[model samples]
Target chain A: MANLPIKTVGVIGTGVIGASWTALFLAKGLQVIVADPAPGAQDKLRSYLEKEWPMMSKVGLGPGASLGNYKFVADINDHLGQVDLVQENGPERLEFKRGLFANLDAKTRDHVILASSSSGLPSSEFVTDCKKNPARVLIGHPFNPPHLVPLVEVVPHPGTGSEYVTAAMEFYRKLGKDPVLVKQEVPGFIANRLQAAVCSEAYSLISRGIISAQDLDKTMTSGVGLRWAFTGPIMTNVLGGGGNFRHMVEHLGPASKVWTEDMRKHEFDASNPQSLNELSNGVEEWVSNIDLESLEKKRDNSMLGLIQEKSKDAA
Target chain B: MANLPIKTVGVIGTGVIGASWTALFLAKGLQVIVADPAPGAQDKLRSYLEKEWPMMSKVGLGPGASLGNYKFVADINDHLGQVDLVQENGPERLEFKRGLFANLDAKTRDHVILASSSSGLPSSEFVTDCKKNPARVLIGHPFNPPHLVPLVEVVPHPGTGSEYVTAAMEFYRKLGKDPVLVKQEVPGFIANRLQAAVCSEAYSLISRGIISAQDLDKTMTSGVGLRWAFTGPIMTNVLGGGGNFRHMVEHLGPASKVWTEDMRKHEFDASNPQSLNELSNGVEEWVSNIDLESLEKKRDNSMLGLIQEKSKDAA
Candidate 1:
């Protein structure tokens, strides 16, 4: 086992999420050794890292951090010797992930902790059967780009030790991220389920002649949405009925019933596609740039400004 | 049914919400007459309007439009003479509301649409039996201070006529406010139910040793919250896990089990008045001088800056 301090973290893929993760680690002064078989992956990640690192540093995160420490390789096994942690951003294919874990088990000595960036597939399915040290295998799901969005769901299988989970949490925290531990493996985790529930209602409203998508968006952005940025849904309800969610439950229950009668299912009708297209175009115009760098920079700058301005007064 | 281009709105109470509604109406350049029994409410509202009016002008929303048309009153009936719409903001007591609706119905002969700002109870229970013109009574719920945040939930009871609902909707729309027809009444309407669901989960996390409340707040603010301000919850999910929400759904469906299992029936346990005192004190310090005037002024400056920035982009 290698005993050098973990200044460098290795990455397995160089797609949007992988590169984003690289930028985050590199920005925090961690040397990132990224290995991706895809052609020109290193060049693409380098460019993304250069732009996003500066923006992230502008917001008061971990000081003395940037993309200067990032080094990329075309071979996977070459990274196993050096990394303190290995965050795999491989294709979401079960067989492919299984193969990677199998190879990693043979190549790496018993030092590096292997974390897969999978949102859906439980860590057990991907790593348990292959690796000799499957206990180190865990899921580290980031929200889009790792640099800007700070929520990372650290999920582990039953055999996974608590020590590894603790270490993983600390690692993410050091990077100035909000790492939420998933007690058990489940689909979508915490944020996604809540999002789906909201999306389901939003889509149903449009399908049931309740309101247009733009109006639905406006209803959120202008009304409940602003307060929600400061407080979670439950806290809003607490203040909503004057510090009594029970009162809200007692009152709004009828309206929910009125809606359940017409709850739209999963089938996407013809109108939905057209509406989605219209919405997509509108979103593109608003967001403008589709690249990872621009999106990350925009999120970082705006987020910092908002936090400085509003966070001071929020409960 | 005296109808001569119903141009003005009468506000019943001049509390925070009532004042905000007046600000919104006046900002839209419509005539507004405000009445409240509370001492100094008239002066406070005027100060609020004066500060907010210029901001509205700075945002290119118009100047004289919001300022010249406001009238304050000590008696409710005085404002009812020329107003075409009435926004009720009485105390949260059902009896008090029933009594007020009775008076409002008898006081004016104008085809004025009456709407309540109740967070929970539908106008149906409050006005189903009391009004001579029962069709005029509906619910118009706004997030606090309607001037800045602009979505209004326009909910009409079964007894309420479509003409009143349509007219009320058009009125809000004409004010450049987003009005959503709830289609049917639900407890907490559309916004607070969603809020409750999120809060329940968040509170559970805090109570359960899974994470600290402050950390959760930071997580939301840093991770999900920033994206929410620009992209919103649904769009964030669409961008979060690869492409549209399908992949996220597939992965998250299982992960949701942990949340629901942990979410539990969380009662807002304010038993520890210590925490409450501390949090309140913190918010107070941050907002020691944040009266309606200051809030309006801040909103105006931001909106003005936002408009100018956007206009520059357009140019």
Candidate 2:
């Protein structure tokens, strides 16, 4: 089963993530069977693909890839058996996921892999509802704008089969995605936890009036973010240590400890209304004068160019 | 003083940071007076510039920029009076900075801005030694490899004058550097604190055996790092919330709080030898089969390409 080719993909719930996944699957020349209950979701997905197709082409499309390669269904249950794998992107609520996965389990073949695009909830929370082949269910979470970005966190539950994990990893890798096998189920997984860590510190700095939102963002885009885009913090630590990880840890670890201690004193508290207001207002002031639509377009275009630039490297 | 155009720069120390600063200054078409006491320091600085000149040229050189525009002096104090702005990258020691800055304060003209590229210590920590015109002394901390990276944290001590702050900002901006004025001196300033936050979380994940060091780095370079390269976290939250930052905070903030709390439990304690070993060994295993020299070259080249791609955007 691990070596079986996944020629068709079932994408349930064609929201933002789902649509992006659909676009990627189509670009990979796979027949994507999409389902969504929301009104106009089909049109929205089509429009999104139309807007994103050129960028996808620039990134290089798969053999036989086409915009008309997918079929939309109002009920995913009707076409569940046709797909080699299932990508569930229903609402993030646990109850919704529990019901959706259970239905998916009942309809799909036992050999079919069931993956969720949940950013927060672990697959274990909902997989228990699947009466058959729960071992195949796992999390295949991608960063936002999945078609453009390459990261896919392939997280498996404790009881998830090793073979299915391999299949999921191979499937995503074959599609040109960088998939990491998460060994444990942690809240927010790896990427989001890392993102939250940065955001928490950023929010703290802004709330303390130490720096404005714009400057904080500039600090990233112009500084660490540029480095992180090419190197992870661990490898960065290794390189910073002059090609010896121990040297870096011994030299810079103490200062980092002090920074972390200072950072812990000001965690972003969602419960505090004032904290939320301050952060919201800070971002508002930063984006108030700018046209968000054009800014977003520019961001997407820049990301596309960066992806091209990065691909030139052997990594 | 704010309106004064800086034609000459005094660069103290010729280590990695100092050399990079010298390269940037020369590339900016400024006559640079560099001083370092280390043996063969002048040769090392010239070699570093020779190797990095091509990348800087690709990023675009300032008018009249030349490799021979710099003069290396054995003692910075001798030519401190010749420069309009002094960028100090001396050893990171309190006593060293105190003594160096005191000499800088006494030798340089009262109007010349004395800027230290110190990463850990604040400007105030050493400025007390500058009895004459301490207001001209401040921290102009740049991220590593300052010649390529754009961020420079322009932090001022309480006694530092606003005109110098304005001068520092204007001077760095003129050289195509993104200078963020840190309103208050905080531990790790802005960029390092944010970086430490992400590193701490990354260390925890790797130490806990939840992910490999390579995957953790891949998670960043392939995921959030891509988005961060273009948009900062605050604006990212704003866009994530559908153009309303308040909405994003209210929605994702709770989950982020949970992640932060979990992250706090596993702070990277430098005192723990076992913890340091775990992180160091993890990174070692990841890089064991890779070539460090080529990787560094690849990273620097990729960064240069990214900078060029980013410069196209209006921001």
Query: Lowest summed lDDT over 10 consecutive residues: which window, candidate 1 chain A?
Result: A261-270
Global lDDT scores for all candidate models: 0.64, 0.87
lDDT of each residue in A1-315, candidate 1, tens digit only: 233345778888989889888877877778888888888877887787776666667644455565567777767686676668888899988889988887776666565677888866777887745647777778888976566666788888888778778888888877767687777665555555555455655654555445554566656655555545555444444444554444554464445443333332322232355644544444444344456445534545655565555534432
Candidate 1 residue lDDT tens string, B1-315: 433456778889977788877877776677888788888877887887776666566544644464768778778776566777888887877888888887888776637788898877788788744646878889998875566555688988877888888888887767666688887775566665555445544544444444444454545555555456555654565556544454554455444544333333332233445533443343334334435344444543553343244234325
Which DockQ values do the candidates obtain, in the order shown?
A: 0.22, 0.84
Once fitted onto the true fold, the runs of candidate 2 whose alpha carbons sit more than 4 angstroms away are none
User: How many collisions between residues are there in candidate 1?
Assistant: 18
C-alpha RMSD by candidate, in order: 7.0, 1.6
TM-score of model 1 vs. true structure: 0.71
